[model samples]
Target: MSDLYDNLKRTVEDLAAPADEQEAMLRKARVGPDELALDFDAFAAAALNLVESGELSSEAYEAVRALDAHLVAFSGANNAAEWTEDALYHSSNWATARELASKVLSLMG
Candidate 1:
């Protein structure tokens, strides 16, 4: 296990959480604004580190990659409204991200 794995685990846990729980996590991590960016960035870095280190299985790495792509797309859309705490519960992208993150966790395990 590495710090990259720990960071990835923490981020993925938050991402895999239920909407309300995830929002609580975001709020707790918030320093100013766009708090989700922090964790999302951590996830990206962790995946990259693991890939470079050859520490993760291909299947697990692909799962992480898929979730990363999904989230990156959602965030890239510039749809600020959907990122809000209230909007998260109703956002299909968030739902899919959560599902994908959970799948990644399962694959990693």
Candidate 2:
């Protein structure tokens, strides 16, 4: 399997480890609050590699799909929030979208 697949497998396994260990492992991998956004191009390249290699099982693929969906929603909400804050004078819709996006981004971390 590719290194990306190996890394993903290890991360998934680490997530399933004992509670304390899992927490520690996650903490190590987690990006800081200020660095929550991923480089979607890089993410897509890695994901495509996994798919092309058939390294991801169906369950893993499903999880990846869910992650992708979350990323998209989070990005949209984030952009909306930024626009509202910078140009729209903090509209309620922008605030609400930002709040929701923050929650989703937190899950990724």
In order, the Cα lDDT scores of the candidates are 0.74, 0.43
Q: Write the per-residue lDDT of candidate 1 for residues 11-82, one digit (tens) a residue.
A: 787778887787777678663224554675666656866867877777888888888788777664567776
lDDT of 2: 0.43
Q: Which 10 consecutive positions of candidate 2 have the poorest summed lDDT?
A: 32-41
- Which stretches of candidate 1 lie above 4 Å from their native place? 31-34, 52-54
TM-score for predicted model 1 compared with the true structure: 0.83
Highest TM-score scorer: 1
- Report the lDDT tens digits of candidate 2 across residue range 27-66: 5867321122243323433665676677655445555555
After the best TM-score superposition of candidate 2, give how far the Cα of residue 26 lies from its true spot, in angstroms.
Answer: 9.7
